[model samples]
Target: MTTYTAINLIARPTGGPIGPDLFEVVQKELPSVGEGQFLVKQNHMSLDPAMFGWMSPDTESYIPPVELGDVMRSSGIGEVVDSKHPDFQVGDRVMGMMGWTEYRLTNGVGLNKVTAPLPDEAILSVFALPGLTATQGLYSIGKPKKGETLVVSGAAGSVGSIVGQLAKADGLTVIGVVGSDEKADWIINELGFDGAVNYKSENLAEQLAELTPRGIDVYFENTGGPIQHHVFERMNAHGRIAVCGLIADYPKQTPDLAPNWIPIIKKRLTIQGFTMPDHFGEIPALLEKLTPYVMQGKIKHRAHVLNGLESAMTGLNLFFTGQNKGKLIVKI
Candidate 1:
């Protein structure tokens, strides 16, 4: 009789930072790998801002909330340790929504085999949700053109970094909105973004104005903070905006007032909000568009890894604090 540990959501976040109070850690007996099923030993799991919405009680969200007492919903990469499925082998590497657990027994319904030579961190950072989301939103919504100016909030994050790089590769003038001088410097210096605005710095409007003198042609919004209004003010006519995450308002009891629609009408902006689950069918095409950038060295990534499974209980706070330097992953 072997036991494995798993974390379950017990309560929704009320306010403030996420802590252990919302979760319960329990040990469970490992299940046998029945016929047509395979047992996975999860090696690494992604920690995303999306998880916050998943844990919320909002049934209207793009995906269902993580039910109370259920293993917290998350995507992870693992190796098949025991298998009875004909399609899966014992040493096969697979990734999907395996949740916050050390092990999972599944019939390979949603799981996809990982055949890339990259490590788990790189795979998750670029090829998984971050890369997929970036490609989907940038190509489908942004409609970016060469020489156009593009601004991406949360530019140093997994999705934002990829978005900026892809736009830069396409000859767009990429400007990233980050939270710190270090992140701003990394995006500009390392990721090759044309410019970066530290949202925490003074004179945000002036900095953005100086950088995007031509006006923003494409906006990849990840954090809806003061920077949003500034960017909204400068959008070019017929501009496109891809509304991704709004980490800025996630913690507030009452979110800040959004920018007026007068600008949207005046600018004739194409503002669209999207979630990856809706476009899961288009993953192969998104990958086809993104892989060349990665293969050509146009895409670069970093992983901020936390050790152990329980670290996830508090690891989420890194998103709010802007402490995570890159993609957040739990090395289980």
Candidate 2:
């Protein structure tokens, strides 16, 4: 028998989650692969904004709430230590929906064998789910043109960072909406965004008016709530909106819009809600197109990695509180 550490969600969260309490780290025994399944030793576990929604006690959602006393749901990358599956082998690198467990067992329905080698961190930051997300959200919803304005909310975060770079490469004037000036400086100066507006700094509408006087054609919406409400008012006619995640309203109930989303209708926006797994067929395309840029560092990646499984909640809080710069990951 193989033994390992697994992080399990002990309870459903009513509101904002706190460290350790939201999850319980425990040592668990692992069984050998029965027949078709492969076993992996996890090295990197993703901390996604969607994880909070998945653990919500609320009944409304696309995914079922994490049942009480279950290993927390997450995506991870690891090396296969042992295998009974023919498709995988001993020491094959793979990416999949394996949760926080150090050792995973599954029939490999969702896992994809990562044909390419990852960086020193075991898996490339952009090669995992966040990388896939940027590709999906950008091309699927954002049709950025040579002379258009593209703005990414949560611009300093993983998906948003990728979104800006991809748009800039496509020849669009890019603006980023970030949480802090330090984040703003990094995204604008280091990452090559045309400009960035710190939501904490000034009026978004005013900034949009100054930077994108011609109006915004594409918006990669990662933060919803009041910011999105303001953005809708500044949106151009026939603009496309990729509704990614609403980190601002996470673990908190959103009240009904008093004016009833009037700006969305008036601007004739095309808003589509999305998740990466919902469209797995695009993975090959995403990897195919994104690989070249990543290899060359044309499309950059940033990840704030927390050591071990204990900081999962803390890392998530960094995201929720706007303290993080890019993709949040827990290195196990």
Candidate 3:
């Protein structure tokens, strides 16, 4: 009999910040695969900001919360260890919305077989939803142009980092607003953003104004609060703002401020909030375009992967604390 250790949500968080205590690691015996099911050794679980939302109970959300006593919902890379299905075979690598466990058995409906001939962890990161979220948010909401300025808050996180480079690739002068100097350096020096503003230290509004003299053409918003509100004040006429994820506001019971009507009406800007899941219909189209850049090493990636699936919660904690330099990934 095979058993696996998995993280389970013991209780839902009512309010305030979530803690590790809310979850428990439990050992569970795996049932033998049925006729059509396959089993895989899980690896590379995604630790996203949206996980925080999962902690809340039954909130109106993009995805439902994890019921108490349920295996924590997650997406991960898995290697087919055993199989009883024709579509999946032993030694195949796959990805899907799985659970936080060492091994998983499924009917292979949601699982997509990733060809190892391309790259080992390629499906784990770039070809995953994080990249999709970043790419889709910008192109769909932020119609950037050559020589225009694009401001990205939370600029060093998984989605934001990708947004910065892609915006730059679209010929926009990218200004990243990050939490740390190291994060700022990575975006500016490596990711090739035009400049970086360390929001933790800099005079944010003044810096944004000076940096974007002509005003910002697009704002890829990931943080909501005073900084985002301030960013609204310096928008170019007809600027586009894509509200993807709000890290600061998620932990709070309420939002920092109401929608900014002042700038939107005055600047004639378009502010749209979206989750990539809602835009999954266009993923194949987006991936097709992104592959060339990835292959050419133009739109490359950086992953801060931690071995062991149990570390997914830890990886997410590291991400929130700004310890993660790039996309935080957990390898089972």
Best by TM-score: 1
TM-scores of the models, in the order given = 0.99, 0.93, 0.94
Off by over 4 Å in 3: 15-17, 116-122
What is the C-alpha local distance difference test score of candidate 2? 0.81
Q: Order of candidates by lDDT, top first?
A: 1, 2, 3
Per-residue lDDT tens digits of candidate 2, residues 1-332? 65788888887666765577778888888877778988888888888888888888767787787877888888888889888988899888888888878888888888888777556243546777777898898888887779988888999988899889888888999999888999889988888999888887667777768888887899899887566766676779889889898887775765435224666678787888898768788788888887887777777667788898777866778877888767788888
Q: Candidate 2 clashing pairs?
A: none
Location of the lowest summed lDDT over 10 successive residues in candidate 3: 116-125
1 versus 3: better TM-score goes to: 1
What does candidate 2 score in Cα RMSD to the true structure?
2.0
Report RMSD for candidate 3.
Answer: 1.8
Model 3: residue 286 alpha-carbon error in angstroms: 1.6
Off by over 4 Å in 1: none
Best by lDDT: 1
lDDT at position 280, candidate 2: 86
Candidate 3 per-residue lDDT over residues 196-305, each given as its tens digit: 88877757878878888888889998877677866788888999999987787776667677565976788898989998668777877988867776777766567788
